[model samples]
Target: MQRAQRNSLRLLQWMMAASLALPVALFVIAATISYTSTNDIADREIERTLDVAHEHALKVFETIDRSLAELNEVVRNLSDDTIRAREPALHRRLKRLTDSLPQLKSAWIFDADGKALVNSLASPPPALSFTDRDYFYSHIDQSIGTFIGMPLTPRPPYQGARFFSVSRRRDSDDGNFIGVIQASVLPEYFESFYARIGSDPGSFFAMGRADGAVLAHFPRLNHDLRLDPGGPVGQQIAGQPERGLMTIAWPSDGIERRIGYRRIAEYPIYVSAGLETSAIRARWFATMGQHLVFGIPATALLFLLLAFAFRRTQHLQAEAAARREAEDALKHSQRLEALGQLTGGVAHDFNNLLTVIRASVDLLNRPQLTEERRQRYITAIADAVARAAKLTSQLLAFARRQTLKPEVFDVGQRMQSLHDMLATLLGPAIEIVTRLSAEPCLVNADAGQFETALINMATNARDAMQGKGRVIFEVETATTIPDTPAPVSGNQGFVRVTVRDTGIGIPAARLGRIFEPFFTTKQVGHGTGLGLSQVFGFARQSGGEVTVTSEVGQGSTFSLYLPRVPPDLRSQRLAPNTAPAVAGSGMSVLVVEDNIELANFAADGLTELGYNITLVDNATDALAELIVDANRFDVVLSDVVMPGMTGLDLAQAVRDRGIGVPVVLTTGYSQALSQDGAAGFDLVQKPYSIEELSRVLHRAARLRRVRDGAAE
Candidate 1:
């Protein structure tokens, strides 16, 4: 019996050691995998940053080169005396070009003697000599296509700004070098762009000459720092001369970083992007910390449970029941707490929002308010109205029931227009970068909703980042969506608008339900959780899709995919209507609405527009009037939802009774409109301006008149 007991004790010891070893081994493997993945992601991000810089540099250089070529073509055969004589015309041309391209600060034409003949900076030309300028000297002896020189800060009489010169060697008909034509490129342009793309602690973007002269750097250095000719990056550029990546300690700060460098095509310029190695490792550690937080506790709990079972085997059944009971009670308490928090969160947000309008109204009611204060109160009321409207629109959008008037528009062009607006809305603290595709991204979507969706995403990004970060809008054409299970049909292409933000990202466990209305990860009263749902619904209603990808501490990317409108269909749209006469000239109209105030308002508004109006409270009475004499009214206007019969049903009955008067419908929200969509009739959304209503009604009336005339 003693021997048996000793053996059992030894077996239990071995079991405990195996259980502990398994968890430790699994954890080690997980950590290794996590570290490798984190580094790989960081490397890709660095490469992408390099690509952006490279593309930007290439575009700017190409523009400068083209401008130079144009100048050469004009002056290659003209003598120095003729060019000098025509300096006035040339200066105007240069000014126009500079004005057209924001990248250029100025343009200049220098003679063989290195004397400036024409420039965009001043009316005629500054009494400046280019003999000592690097751009002029570099091209004097070489047949280079374009010589991009180092950055220089100009002296007095010129703007105290830094810019780099891009020049080409001007040659005569006989291939003899004559002079140099150069454009001054604003370094602030590139620096501003760099600031938008990356905003991390040790992020850097640098452009330099092949000979290691620094042209520009973002997070601009106080003093110039050139790349070492013998350094890893410089040596690679010297050898390969196209593109490369390396890890090295920066000479300026001795900080180790992973850098990616690329040469602008056939130009002696290079753009390099670097991210600190320590930053990358810190990100890795953050990821590992999350894992450890969950894993260590879980493993300890399992071990404790196993030891308890071994020590108290005889009492295991009773303890198991007690443990299960405690878990149930805890889970019940958590559920109640979560529900209460969510309910309170929604109520708190709405109440706070309402206070703005309420306070403004109370202030405006005061008798002795000053004009300035009264105006301020009025402005406050307007702003509150707009916010309330936005909130309602968001909820309606999430419900997929908002009335949408879709039209074919270029998505890229729209994005370009929003650049300024987004910059203003996001404020100075956040940078907005856009990488719009040159190719047309035409989609049939509601323009207003499209803007709203983008704004929602940007606002969410701002919150996630704590109001200060980078938001990048990248638009491109794609045939396949990466996160989808299967590719969309090949015949139909998609315009993918990606909004990427550097923010504390959504947790993986919560990503699946991000589009569920009222489900949010934000703190209480911060959000209603309807923003992403709006995006999801708009994409779906427009026959598109939305997807997202994120890492815990890295950031999130929300991709909105919309179907590209076919070229043939775009061409088939009807021509714009001829500007109609504003005066209704006694054209009769019947208005049907459920609300008495709305009916009277429409009647009064239409009468002002010179249209005679017959108003009714319900569609049933409106139909009786229309059936009496269809020709009495030029058009029938009705609301979609009414007491007995809907406006849509009334229109259908008008047709069934052989009444020929055209019918127009209006609604703030309706299931019929959402599902059937206007039903082959003109529609005007409710709360529409009088101008919009007049135009829509006039169009319908004119169309009816034409139909009657054709029949006659």
Candidate 2:
């Protein structure tokens, strides 16, 4: 009886051991199956994403190409010699063309002599010549369907922005080539398009042009993310025509991700999609856990019947999960790398603008003037200085360097006040029209800045007309919602003020850069190219935007959109105050300036104004004159930028020598000299009318007297 009982116990122990081992083996098999399934899904998702991204990218490229084609067609039709000779009508057509296609910067017809017959910009330069351009030479063949020129800076009547020119030869019925029709397109158009791909939160997209130029991206990466086609991924990209999945470390973010990249076969750009490794693994892990639960029970039965099947399933799951995670990480990195390159380029251009403003201001203060014309000279000098100050302010705003001071006001009323001034400024040749809304349109903005912007727009319109054309000013109000179609490109809800002109229209080529500072189509002395730039800065600073539309001949329109302001906060209008005059007790003054003609003119004006004047060309001579007889000079008036010493330096020197005379610095460029550190000195800007100069001098004299009295 004892032996039989022991045998039963041993049998039971063996059975229990088998039950536990079978389940463990089955669980391993199930986990392997789950990982394989998850990997397959991940691969399929990657392929789909890549395919979709490529298709979308191609669509964008095609749209741009179509726009370019339309512009080329317009250029071809307008380049005829007969059409060129017809002034006003030919100009109107060109304006219409540019107005219809806002993307074009500027368009023009170059006659056989390389003279511009028509230009869409404000004023086509006199004696304009472009016979030496590569596009003109290449188009001479006439066989090239459409000649696309490399990126270059456009010559006058167009400035501030770089553009690529598209040209086609225009021929008469006799197969004789007349001229080349060329259109300019801004690089920013491509940048704007690429910015709209997707908002996948943690995920980002990127595109690279054929020449290894990183075009666009999402989640704004820093400058270091540029992808070099000579690099590993770039090499891989070159080799593959179809969609691909790979693991890559994006140079910009330095994060490893699973990446899917596809070359846009029809276009010159490559599109990429990226997924984080953590995201992929987390998804796979969840799927694997669920599979393990079911697989363990099933595998236990299978292990009892077949042990080899369970071992194979376990191995497959582990391998699949690792592969998927690696691929996703690589794609994310590449996209970021491409984005960094584009941002860097934009930053570099912005810095260049700052440099130009700084240099121009320093040069303005070098010229000399006389006492009588000092006030007029000072007013002209002040105008330029003020613009320079505005430029720095814009940079600060763009960089988020300054705090905003927004206020509420009626946009319509403000525009109405500007209309009278615009009418006077645009002149008789250009008909001025107003289409203001009857109901008031409120907006939040800086009133003084807004007025300046309005004036700038009016001036731009006047230039577009070349002293003859029609300018239509209109204002309207509307509420905006998310995803709604914007009235202008890259804009949202705001008050829209449209300034349209029937002058020479902007070409599609030069349309994008009209707002860039120093990018002007006017002759060098005719315009500073800062008009639209100031408008852009003011709009942006006030939480608004400025968009432009133009055609080569049809015309150009600028639309300013400002955020709506509540009624209660509008600024009260202040009456213009008359400037107080300085009560000089027949004191002698010293005037220093480098330009002889201006200096002589100023001295004559001051003599007429009953002031005794001693003129010098620079700060050194003025100081010498003062040292020879300190009592001879009541005040030292000097231009800021000079060869020997700056105006500020001279002022400091005079103070150190115990000369108690007042110093007034005059300049054309004020950006460098208007900072807080340089604020104590009196300033007068260049290009001022005679009356304006007198006002500033009087104020300076009065301030000096007050200071002198306080010292006594």
Model 1 off-target regions past 4 Å?
A: 1-383, 429-431, 483-490, 518-528, 571-585, 608-610, 655-658, 706-712
What is the C-alpha local distance difference test score of each model?
0.83, 0.65
Return the top candidate by lDDT.
1
User: Candidate 2, residues 147-212: lDDT per residue as tens digits?
Assistant: 556566767655766665656676755767777767776555544543544443335466665666
- Model 2: C-alpha RMSD to truth? 51.7
Clashes of each: 0, 75
**How many angstroms is residue 605 displaced in model 2 relative to the true structure, after the best TM-score fit?**
2.5
Encode model 1's per-residue lDDT on 336-380: one tens digit a residue. 786675567456666766898899899999998999999998898
TM-score, every prediction = 0.47, 0.32
lDDT of 2 at 318: 47
